[model samples]
Target: MGYSPSVHKFAEGADVPVPLDLELVRAVLEPHDVGDPRLCFDPDGDLQFWIRAGDGSEAEIFAGDTGILVERPHSGGVFGIVAELVSRLGAVAVDPSEGRIVCSTEEYAHLPVSMRKDAVVIEMTGERLEAALLGRRPA
Candidate 1:
């Protein structure tokens, strides 16, 4: 089974956190129309949808106020698309499988990070990555 990776949202050009929701993702992708964002509604705070790649392959997007999760990404181009997608949202794509930020080497160098037990910790919260997503460790 393919694992899910997630994006961390922050203020534009800044490290301050921001809300990540379906509306924000829709707004970022509406004009480009690069992929079809399936629309649905739920009173629950979280939602999921399909994000297609240029090659017609797709992945699932789980979006909520806390964060966005992407799974079963089969296309190479999806990473490129994701980079652009997150950039538009002032966020970063993190690959939990790789335990590193999905970014260029130079960009990765500048991220505020710490290594703990071979785990990459985002200094933003000093949290360990869980299921390829950043999560705070139990206190």
Candidate 2:
């Protein structure tokens, strides 16, 4: 994981092609290192994914492994902002050549977007998003 943007893909709730600012994503994620395997679980069990990173590591995100997942303790605006960013990023990174891409819930909807796909909510809240990616499992 030598910070190759072209080596990544994004998939959201749509089938259309979308361009992403890899630099932006990198800026958001570059501060952390790849570590743990995070999980997202939707009520309907329709969507799932994880992010792996660690201290001083680049974050790697993945989706579509669980049901319609939603993280808790989030308000409408925050959720929307995060969903927008994640879905936008996902849409860009998802490879149509491999399979289908879905957004599931629209931005601002009740969709869950983990700060880091690999770590637990505690780790995310504790500012350990980067540590989790470095293969550090949450206690």
Deviation (Å) of 63 in candidate 2: 16
RMSD to truth, every model: 9.1, 15.0
lDDT top scorer: 1
Q: What lDDT tens digits, residue by residue, belong to model 1 across residues 35-105?
A: 33445334574665665656665666666775777777654445445556565565556775665554333
Error of 1 at 105 (Å): 9.1
In model 1, the Cα lDDT at residue 119 comes to 33
What lDDT score is found at residue 51 in candidate 2? 28
Candidate 2, residues 102-130: lDDT per residue as tens digits? Answer: 23223212222431232122211222321
Q: Quote the positional error of residue 8 for candidate 1 in Å.
A: 0.4
